[model samples]
Target: MATPRTRGAARAAAALAAGVLAVSLTACGGDDDGGDEDKSGGTGGTGTTVTLPRLDGESLEVAAVWTGTEQANFKKVLAEFEKRTGAKVTFVPAQDPIINFLGSKIAGGAPPDVAMLPQPGAIKQAVERNWAKPLGAGAQAELAKNYSPGWQDIGKVDGKQYGVYYKAANKSLIWYNTQVFENAGAAEPKTWDELLTTARTVYDSGVTPFSVGGADGWTLTDWFENVYLSQAGPEKYDQLAKHEIKWTDPSVKEALTTLAEIWGKKDYVAGGASGALQTEFPASVTQTFTGGDQPKAGMVYEGDFVQVNIGETKAKVGTDAKVFPFPAVGDAPPVVSGGDAAVILRDSEAAQALATFLASPDAARVQAKLGGYLSPNKSVPDSAYPNEVQREMAKALIDAGDDFRFDMSDQAPQAFGGTPGKGEWKALQDFLKNPEDVAGTQAKLEADAAAAYGN
Candidate 1:
């Protein structure tokens, strides 16, 4: 989601873009399975690698919401960039709420050479405000070589490319404790009905079937978006995000009602609705692993970034943790995804060089090797990741092709999509708390949508 600090703040952005939030790695443990050198780079449709000009005597500062292992991993990539070009690059951690900080920096005429924005809306906003610069030739060449058309489209505003998505997260995943599933004799659900049946089986096994992170409302939005995408399809999803359709539309009601089958089920969800309404994202993961006073939550739905939060728990990933793509509700399962879209805010040779470097398969390969970093660059290989789970998730994301949808709320305005206690987040919260009031929730949602989008 956008500008999420791991800041897990995708909820705070009102997150995400959840990539306005983070990725599909670490859901399984990092195995350091240093098998063979990845050969997926330098192929496919883009066919041209953008090579940046060597910077033997220059320095640049870049900003992103990364720290700890994530920061170190990116730094390793940057270090390689520095080594290859002799440019000294300084990595600055963006503030918890990055938009305001970035705006202030721009106003002061000191924006970083490049800023990694996780939210698609944020990138679009920057393009609209004329704060972003179009990609230079080197960057454009890399985009042509490495990224898919859909990803290329994500960074565009009015046909001008102003951003590059270096990192990605598959938001269409459900992470579960393996032991819980094995105990319930549950297999991964391929269809929504199957999912509900599995939930019942899991509940019958004396475990909470799902962990709803109602406290962090974005998680709830993810629940709604996935169902909406599969139920209503991508064209409608984009139309709604752009305010081409009202939230009160029947399709929305259908999606929300479908959600109620699970949300409304008592004990099917860990801690019940009230308890979930208070559990933030971190607690959602911890509780799934910990189970607190109840049997463990059999499954928790989140992007691959959930792996980091899972790391905070005692359970081992891959061995103890497992994941499945979010099940299909309609004719097709939805491939909803998001990532950190890096946009150049200041136009300079240094900025252009950094942007170009970031767009290349080489730069992506460096971080992909470290785990938790998924690249939209089509050429990057499955083996670039450290583990099989991540490798598979990466492949699924790529295979979804142009049919993929970025996180819905993340593609809308922050006031409508990313704020706290306002707009979609609050409306979805009300729905979670009172699933029987479907019509009432629809009205509230539309009213909020109108206010936020000024429709």
Candidate 2:
């Protein structure tokens, strides 16, 4: 769902903003030594290990939407698997809503051995469509050893596990151009009202306050999720995500009304709503950091992965660019996350072996060393991250523990959440274009959501 780049000034800034924060021994990172202590792929936290089956001359295909640095880094992980088990693993690039991609492949009877499913609803869909296989005992054990229960549960359908989430994103973050804040004499806002005040301050200083990546419907979903997760709280968030509650709920309206406070104001967003609707995710981030002392926008919101796009600019991460958690809209700030899970699409001994390796901290360690990545594996050491900022961000996510919620849009069916220009994505995009139509927006959202949810 994110584009990538080579690590440079923007990369450093993005790395900082991406929450390359620290993780402690008690958090996701444990006290294990950096080296592989055992060939068994042992779990540091569980003190148990599993011997992976040797795949000798076997070949496997692993698919995901990752490209650029992300794909490059994951190949490093796959390379390690090849070296360890003598199996050849090929990386297959898939499209967004990967379920559709896999569906075509499955229809052609040429499915990859394994696929990375980005949305929980997609994993469920794969299982329902019989395109995904339940993980073998070996892979399941690895997940139990390293992953949090919440992470583990996300890959399950009807109580049977299918995916091993190998990549995670902290979606509730706003990365800003620090020079903009300094010039405007603004501090990071701690509350929703304060955020608006800061925006006003920035605007008064002759700068647009925020960049909304409205071209990508998913970005709009992220904005709504953060507000709804904070304003309405988790229980209702879960209900809405599951379609147990309709989009027309008062909580939904309240969040929309609150979001309109900023989005409704043409001056607050870069290029205004019409312009924002034309800005893609990469441009939304680059515009904030590219203009030196004066940029088109002061801030852009997304996951820590925004750093990848940030790398496209000349800004130094901690210096020219920085991040603050999404400002609190209710009693507490929201921590909405997203991740990609490795699921077996064509089950076999080799595929199961690949799944097991992905669940191990061994695999997570490989990518963690590369910048702009986060892992939910509790056993990977803090030292695995290249720097302190990543460790700090990692620490924040791991620290959230039970308070954490996965991205709400990702929890819904792809037709509603993942699809571009449809369902919540399209409805929210329309809402962004016309923030004053709260009732109209709510009705449209309800209609799309009901159709998507089959309710």
Candidate 3:
């Protein structure tokens, strides 16, 4: 379906196009120097620019949950930082699970100089426990002025900034095959009822309407968060985030009921409940676009990162797949989930330099060039995006305004959070197995969350 681009997306596109034109002109003209002059190391009294100090003689280590494609992109940025500054970054890429590695390190009192925490709960915990240092007023002001409002708030703990944000992966998007929707004579649904009707119409046409994977447990949590915000609004969501509301609240129940109803539909989701339970997130995401059908599934509700996994297949972004905001249900504003903020441990000079560089628009442009994500920086143009899908996602993010919230699973405490082998993950798996027991499922979750929060 040809969903009309929202005003925010249109504005972002215009900004991006203008930025791209300027960049092209500058590139052609060989204007190599363009950055914050005050911040950029320029000529000094000694007729030599003061370079960022090397980490070779410095005692500092960095740890993070970055691996695979993300690691490569991170390394590329870090390498540039190291060269610009004389710092030797000893990056310990932990493929051996993030929490386990960091838990041990933090306990030993020898934590790394920087840690790229993908989970908001981990970032919050780190701040609460005094495991990291605040970025201070100066850094916070720079970030607020440079990045998106959503990103600026992500790093705030007790109204103080604790991290410097860089890349963001928007999750409140629904990706669909454009051709399939067009052929089905379907338009992107604007309201929850419209969405359901559209899904039913698409399903009645013999194609699966949605491809959701609940088997990973984390995926189910996504549904919960989406519905919660849609039903209760962002204010209530914020209350939930701050532990002011109970998980067993009526609003939470209503959201769970909506998920159960959606999941209960025959062929509403590909592979059924069993399929959703056993499949990994990426595999589940790929299921929506698999095979030679003109358009396999109508939509796949997932994060912006889904484009990265889909890129490995025969379908290319934009042509084969495009994204729209997960339509608002009732009076709720459109919301999207994603991760934000990159935290520096404050001990290493190199790490601080790296953080400063990343907070700049230059680093944001670099992230866009690498693909598979969007920068939280509003000033960075989307024209730097390599593909149309990335461009679309970036535009959606900028348009989301204050309605954008991080994934609930990531926002909760570690115990309630769906980390591997956690109770939250286990409960989701159990709930999916028996979709009839909605109350039982919620009770289990409420108990778990209360225990975790000491409520």
State in Å the error of residue 381, model 2.
Answer: 1.1
Residues 1-455 of candidate 1 have per-residue lDDT tens digits of 22222222112112222221133223335564646556554432112244556788898888987776688889987887887778999998886346666888888988888888877888877887888899988888889877889899988988989889998877877887778888879887767999999899888888889988898778989999989877886677778988899988999989999999999988887778889988888788877876532445989999887767776777666767777667778755666788887788878887888888888877887787666778887887777777766666676566655556788888887777877788889988988888999999999988888886778
Candidate number with greatest TM-score = 2
Whole-model Cα lDDT per candidate?
Answer: 0.77, 0.80, 0.64
Q: Which candidate, 1 or 2, would have the higher lDDT against the true structure?
A: 2
Q: Which rank order by lDDT, best down to worst?
A: 2, 1, 3
> Per-residue alpha-carbon lDDT of model 3 for 21-59, expressed as tens digits?
232222211111223232222222111122344555544
Which candidate, 1 or 2, has the higher TM-score?
Answer: 2
> Candidate 2, which segments miss by more than 4 Å at Cα?
1-51
Give me the candidate number with maximum lDDT: 2
C-alpha RMSD values across all candidates: 7.4, 7.6, 7.4
TM-score-best of 1 and 3: 1
Error (Å) of candidate 1 at residue 183 is: 1.7
Give the TM-score of each candidate: 0.85, 0.88, 0.81
